[model samples]
Target: MSKSQVEVNRFKVKAQLMQLESDPIAVEEPLQISLVQNNKSEIFSLTMRTPGHDKELVYGLLFSEGIIENSDDVERLESQLHEGERQINQQEVILAEDISIEWSRFGRSYASYSGCGLCGKTSLQALELKQSRALKPIKSKIDNGLIRRLKALLAEQPLFSQTGGVHAAGLVYEKQGELILSKTPFFEDVGRHNALDKLIGHELLANDLNQAGLLLLSGRIGFELVQKAIMAGYSTIVALGAPSNLAIQAANQFNVALIGFAKDQSFNLYTADKNKVVCREPLD
Candidate 1:
């Protein structure tokens, strides 16, 4: 399980009154992901994340960034602790013999913060071509009512409920324009991309990315999130927050259905070919 929150003492102040309380702050830590191939291993990325589901995070990240196509591309994943630390703070991914990787393209020598996704890219052209998978035809449609219900389901995340500082991503399926939550587990991280990566990793490990026709994000939809969704083959992405202009452009180019501001039983479709989303009864 991911360590979602940590207890800290704080002083709460009200007009002329102060109370000491133990607050549950969201946990954030540095996670070093390393890639291992041909008996040689190198640090891949350093990210800030909540401790848990680390292996899934690594697998999802590698797959999303075009490092490996599928679960079969990597033989196994391992973790290494810092000096005497008991917890596995560093992770290593070993590629299968049949797989070939160009580690130079990964920019493994650089470290990026959780807030930015393109920090390591050498050029804008490289970022544009990051996703190796060609866009697949989007055939899935989601009803407004089902999307609202799915959003409500996503709100049940225990980590965010306790800390209110984490982001979440869920894999959802569309059935007859209705929503179906895949068995793939949900992921919560301090970083939005990390959460998405964890969710992607879960689906990859389960070998059911196709079943996840829709993606629900707890935060705003941005270029990075859009790219990850496209890489993972999601036809639709619903976000609780607004969508960035670049995200809209990417979705339009890829023919993905992008919905934003999904709240109060209504959502704004940023880009959906043929206006596929069908609204439902007004929220009571």
Candidate 2:
């Protein structure tokens, strides 16, 4: 089984009381992604991520960076763990023979950290990714009752329940005009972006990116998350935390409906037209 948390002993001190207890900690590890095409290979990115869904992570990374458009663009994906190691440290992604990579455009030293997504880029412009086509508009609405249930869903997270030190992301879809998130890929990572990427990658691998759904984030909505959602063709983003100014701007530009600080049926709509979000009752 893939372990998301590790058990460790820690000393807690408070009010002249000290206690030694066993605690679970979220696991963090390095993941190196390499791209191979036409018998040539190059290191694409090195990121700090929780050890799971490695193949999905690679798919999300490649899709977000505009390296691969459709799932067919990838010829093969291989992952290997170092000898005597329990976690996978490296992954290789081979592109289809007909696809050509823009080496010069992606040529930059990048060290992706677990805390933020736009790390290692020299300029602000580098953060903006150009897409070959605009994201198709999403035409769906989730009720307030369904939104409130997200808290319960998050509460059931085994990793977060044990460690309380990870971000989570999930995908929700509509059925018969009602939102239903059944067996959605729930990902948890020390980094919020990585969690979202894992979910995106999982969907990409299934070739189900065109499904009408909302990307629910356990934390704040940021520019990177918005960009990744856009790249992954997600039309709506809902979060349990606040949205950054840049994230709102990006969502508005890309026509993504962004919601933040969602709790108990109350949420702040940061982007998209007012009519785009239909609540059963007045929401704050």
Candidate 3:
């Protein structure tokens, strides 16, 4: 066993030296996804990730892309770190009967980072094939109370309060009047999209997506988060920060209640048609 070497940078500000460790400096790791087919051997696709949750992350990546629909499609998994290479050994899936998959689509070279969700090839086609479900409109209204609670909860995240480097997604539980606490089931990532994906992957395994509860992010609501949230059946999304223009547009098209800038009892509602947000304002 040995200490993992990390990078630390030094800078100066106001005649002072500042040193910080940029947490998630990328380490090249392999995402070995294997689907054992009957003909002769197993097939695999190697991908690069920030590491951790290699298994469920792989499953979620495959499932969300329509590459592997269920757990049954997984053959077997093995992993090892040798010569500084994270080698994942995969066993080919051999079912009791015949199975068919368009194996050609599993290449990671063609997959874009989840944060940068749109590429010419996977855009419209994925929307049609995967997240085609009509999102339910927001039936209840969110008041100033909700916005205040969201920002407070987001600020309370101990990780970002320290590192300022990770992303988080949690289900908010509103209890006694004006009191809210979030249930954190997943909190680990350099990307918001990965945090959401990891949470959704765990929930899907447990058959719990309807409770698609409130999402409090450390940063702005980007297009991919909006898209993934809608696809996962969460009609309402609240971010402690702002919302990108494309994020708002996607939420409107998908019928998701897009709420942003959730701080100091203020929030911007992007989809009034779906959210019970004020249709008109006193600011007028």
What is the lDDT for 20 in model 2?
Answer: 52
Q: Give me candidate 1's TM-score against the actual structure.
A: 0.56
Question: How much is the lDDT of residue 131 in candidate 1?
Answer: 56
Error of 2 at 74 (Å): 46
lDDT of 2: 0.71
TM-score (C-alpha, index-matched) for candidate 2: 0.57
Q: With candidate 2 superimposed using the best TM-score fit, by how many Å does residue 262's alpha carbon deviate from the native?
A: 0.1
- Candidate No. with top lDDT: 2
Top-TM-score structure, candidate number: 2
lDDT values for all models: 0.68, 0.71, 0.54
Clashes of each: 0, 0, 2
lDDT, candidate 1, 1-284, per-residue tens: 23655554433322223345654444544567777888988667776555688878888888888888888998887877766544677778888877777767754454443465535532113435255465444445445556667777777899999999999998765556444565436799998989999998888888776664668899877667888888888878878876655566678788778877677445666565534654345342
What are the models' TM-scores? 0.56, 0.57, 0.51
Tens-digit per-residue lDDT, 1-284, candidate 3: 11222332211111112222232122222244445456454434444343556677767766786766678766555454434433442323343235566656644324343244333342223333247345543344566655565666666678878997888887553333222354656465787877788877876787766553555566667666777777777777877665654466676676677666565534555553422553222221
